[model samples]
Target: MIKKLLPFIGEYKLETILAPVMITIEVALELMIPFMMARIVDYGILGDGGMTYTIQMGSLMVLMAIIALIFGALSGRYAAIAGMGFAKNIREGLFKKIQTYSFANVDKFTTASLVTRLTTDVTNTQNSFMMVIRMAVRAPVMLIGATIMAVSINPQLSTVFIFSIPVLGTALYLIGKFAHPRFLDMLEKYDSLNEKVQDFIVNIRVVKAFVREDHEEEKFVDNAKRVKDAQLNAEKLVVLNMPIMQMTIYTSVVAILWFGGNMVIEGTFNIGELSSFIMYIMQVLISLMMLSMVFIMLIISRASFSRIVEGLEEKPVLDDGDADPQLKPENGDIEFKDVSFSYSDDAEHAVLNHVNLSIKSGETVGIIGGTGSSKSTLVQLIPRLYDVQSGEVHVAGRNVTQYKLNTLRDHVAMVLQNNVLFTGTIKENLKWGNEEATDEEVIEAAKAAQAHDFITAFPDGYDTELGQGGVNVSGGQKQRLTIARALLKQPKIVILDDSTSAVDTATDAAIREVFREHLNDVTTLIIAQRITSVSDADKIIVLEDGKINGFDTHDNLLKSNTIYQEIYESQSKGGGINE
Candidate 1:
């Protein structure tokens, strides 16, 4: 864990070094204050008792206190700035790394886990860094300085100091060993509780629709209880150290006073020296106690850091297409040659079997299948969302894997089944399709997708702020907006995966008509469950169990394709498409 954090601090090496240096200076000043107190008592008060010497020593003590306070304040300010900057750099780096991860890599770490790492885990590490620089350095310096001062004042009184050091060290080591595993468990419970709460909030509508509020509440309660219990156990182990250290400190102080009194009575040490020795011993022991607490915090932070490093170290399953050269295709043609894929290597079933297909430029094709028939999966492969397990996916007569991911995705625009709308104005969402697009271009795309009329009807028109996921808009409006966003891309190929399902049949027909007229030269692939939705396509492919069951024109398929015929007849008789 220390090794992982070293790189984040590397860029701030100057500040990191400077912060500890300032802390050391502050600790030295603090040590001098004690010595100054000893001087005032021994020489200024008990000596010939000259007014000049007393006044001089008293003035020196005031100067030392003021200097200590200034250095302490400087150290604190520098430590805070350095620690916060380190945390910001780390969080930004992690967020960028997450953006580069492939879909497969993202699936390995769930959204809830990522959120916890970005927030709670990073906060723990940041707190530890701040405490280490701000207080951890000073505690050790004070402890060692006080020990030296005590031994110098009277060697016989230093015996208690030596004994108390070992007792504190043992307590810190034992508490750290016990608390490390508990801290890891406690963080895991925290992530589980976060996941449960996120799920409940995101699916609140579903829960209300099904009247399962009590069920969800019970589930959340159970997860929260687990987190509470784990935290309590961790706190119990950590809090035990303080009382044990206090016991050692009190015992050592009692022994120091008892033994020092005997030495003073025997004339081996004077009253003033014994008093200074006891004061130094107390200072040393208290510093050790504070240091022990800092050590435990570092232990817990290390545990959290390990989890964060694990996420950063993960490699994306899909390569960035860096090693491969650019693929210059002959034309906008796509071919899937014996393609097979699965979500995982150990999965019992593949989502797509040995499927083969070819689509020429300027062609319109439709893919019809039941739920889980891999229609969406086939289109996802075109943009390389998932790598083919056993075959090649080619674009423009060249393998897609040979092109950079961004270059390939640039030519292929996809409107997914699950349409997502970010929090922004309608114009802003449309601009995501093409940032340089003019207002005229946006209006044209919106008109083609049959979204212009409704958008203009809104009070603010294109400037209206869309709520999260377009919650303020109807489902049909959201679908049309997504379609408009994709249309504005004007790519070589457009894939609409059941994009028109939310709109009424009349609106769907109008959008299809616009697509036919404006996108005549664009290669289009439509995946739909409604036979009426794809009946006008030049070709239709019916899929069953990951294999092509039939491939023909829609009219020809009505007679030759059993699956297509069944779907058509069912929908014609008021039986909705199964998917």
Candidate 2:
């Protein structure tokens, strides 16, 4: 994990290096102070030549104190720079890597989980890095340095450090070892808490409409309580560290006072030497306390670090680097030959199986299927959103995987069933299809998608600020806006995956008419549940149980295909068929 995180230190390498160096110097200067004060006491205060030596030693001590303060300040500044910079790099790298994930890759993790890893996990790791650079360097140096000084001053009293150090070390090690697993549990509970919050907020309207606020609140409280319980469990172990540290500190201090006071009385140690030894004992114990805190931080951050590394090192399922960049989807010709696919690798059956079909450029194809018939799954494969387990999907005379992913997707525009829209002006959202599109071009695409009239009805017109996910608009309006965005791309192939479901039949027909007139050269694929939506298509595909039950012109299928005949008869009797 340390190796994985080191590279994120990138441009801050100098700050990371300098922080520890400055801290080490500060510790060294701090160790010198107690020894200097000892000399000031024995030779300057208690000796025959009193005033002159006292003044000189006091001046030296003041100089050392000032230098130590400066080192301490520099170390803090450098640690902050290194910690913040490292975190920024990791966040950027995580986001960029997520952008490269295929649909299958994205399906492995949830949005809430990823958000937590990027924010909470990265923050924990950053804090741990800062503490490691500063206290980690200072504490060990102080411990060893103060130990040597105390031994040199009076080895007999220094025996307290030897006993206290080992005891504190054993206690801290046990606390950290026991607390680590609990901390890991606490972090996982945090991920669940974030997930619940996100889900509740995103679906708040549904909760209100269904009068399920009480249920959601109960769920939220339960999740919150779980987080609290897990935290307390982890903290219960950590709380042991401070008490153990305080006990060691007090024990060492008392032991030094007793033995050293006796030595001073016996003339084996001077009063100045005994005083310095007591100060050294305090420094040693305090350094041990600092080291214990560092260990505790490492225990908490270990889980967060592992989560971050999983996101960073996740290999993308699809990569276009091996594809020929020169190859591109020139036209909208599509073919599926013996293609079989499943959402899971070891599923009992494919969601789409043995599918063989073909469509030429400029043709309008309509697909009708039951809820789980995999119509959207079929269209997603055209852009290589997910790869086939066997056989192949071909577009524009080459395998879909042969063309660079960007090249293939650039030519294919899909307005998904969800009809997602960002929180931006109407024109701004449309520009996602073509970032360089002018105002006129955006208007033209909206007009083509039958969205211009409703957009202009708003007071702000094209510049209206949309709520998140276009919440302010009606469902039909959101669908139209998404269609407009996809049309703005002007791709050779356009797939509407039940995108017009919310619009009335008249409006749906108008949108289809506009497609026929303006997109004469673009291949269009429409998936609809209503018979009227596809009755006039150049070809209508009827999918049943992952197989093509019918594939032909609507009129031809009405006479021959059993599934098509039954659907046409039902819709016609219901007065819903268009033609």
Candidate 3:
């Protein structure tokens, strides 16, 4: 997991290397200051050396301190650069990986979970990375350096560390062992909290209309409290870290003071050497304290790092590695042979059964069914959005799996059941279909989708900016705008997945007419709730329980197919027969 994440350091390699080097230099120089102070006291003040030597040693100590400060600052600066750059690259990689995921892959991990991994989890990992580069090095070096100096001064006095150091180490190990699971539980609660908020926000309008704001607030509060409890549970164990250090720290100091005081009185150890030894003991204890803090950070971030790595290492549901790079879709022709698909592993609940169909280029077909007829599922196979569980789906005579995903999807445009528009001008959203589309091409596609007149009515015309999700437009207008965007692709195949249900019959009829005249060469499949929408098609398919119950001209289906008759009767009773 660590190896996979490290490669994202990319351009920050220099800073990653420099940060620890700078910190090592800083730690070394800082260690020398205490030794130099001991020289000033023992040699110059008490021994034969005069005040000049004291002043000289004092000046040298100050110079060392200044150099250490500069190096410390450089280490911090480098750590920040490396840490932030590593996180940025990780985010970019995660996002690009998500783009390649098949629909099945997306379903495996929910939206809220992915968002948490990208934001909060990444932040935690970044802080740990920077600390590891800086403090992780500093703590160990400081501890070893101080211990060596203290042992050199009085080997017997330094034994006090043996008892205190082991005690502190044991406490840290126990705390880390217990706190890891607590932190892991906390991050999962964060996912639940985020899901609660995201679900409420996406459906805010429905909540408002249903007068369920209080219900939502109560649910949110409950989830928020769970998150708080999980966090407190983890922190309570980590909070033990400092108190344990303090107890060990003060106990060692008291022992050193007592034994060394007796030694000083006997002239076995000089006052200056004792003073420097006490400083070294303090440094060693303080370094132990730093280690405890780093331990706590690593325990917490370990959970987050696991999550990020899990997401990063997830193989996309679809792989195009063996696909022919030059395999381009040349026509709108499509065929499905004995294809079977199930969202779950059980074959009894397959969303699409062994279905077979052939659609020729330029054929405009209508597909009619009840809610669970797998109308959308069938067309999704054509573009290779979801691969079949068994058998094959062919586009332009070649198996969809043979071509690169981009090559297959570029020629097949789909307007899904739930249309989405980003926060941008109408023209910008349309250009998503074709980035290089000319103004004339843009106007033509919009005109064909019956969006030009209403768009031109606005003051900004095509350049009018839309609010998020195109909230400024009505549902019907939003539908037409999505149609216009899809038409801009000029794709060889277009799938309208109940995309016109929001628009009125008149506008829907106009859009269909435009398809006939301008998109005549493209194979079009329309999924509709109303029979009139498909009543005039070149042919209509009636799907029942993932099987094709009937496929024929609209008139023949109405005459012979029971499922088609039932659908037509259900819709025509409203007096819009063949509208």
Scored by TM-score, the top model is 3
Return the candidate ranking by TM-score, descending.
Answer: 3, 2, 1
- Per-residue accuracy of model 1 over 380-424 as CA lDDT, tens digit each: 999888998889998988888888888788888899998899999
Model 2 residue 212 CA deviation in Å: 1.1
Supply candidate 3's per-residue lDDT for 129: 91
Residues 1-579 of candidate 3: C-alpha lDDT, one tens digit per residue = 667799999999999999999999999998888888888788898787789999888888888889999999999999999999999998998888888888888888888888998999899989999999999999999999999999999999999977887788789899999999999999999999999999999889899999999999999999999999999999999999988899888999999999999999998998988999999999999988888888889999999889989887889878889999998888999898999999887888998889989989999999999999999999998888888889899999999999999988889999999889999999999999999999999999899989999999999999999998898888888888888889888899999999999888898999999899888999999999888788778999899889999989988997899989887787778686755
lDDT of each: 0.85, 0.91, 0.91
How many steric clashes between backbone atoms does each model show? 0, 0, 0
* Reference-based TM-score, model 1: 0.95
Tens digit per residue, CA lDDT, model 2, 476-529: 999998999999888999999999999999899999999999998999999998
In model 2, state the lDDT of residue 530. Answer: 91
Residue 150 deviation, candidate 1, in Å? 1.7
What clash pairs does model 1 have?
Answer: none
What TM-score does candidate 2 reach?
Answer: 0.96
Better of 1 and 2 by TM-score: 2
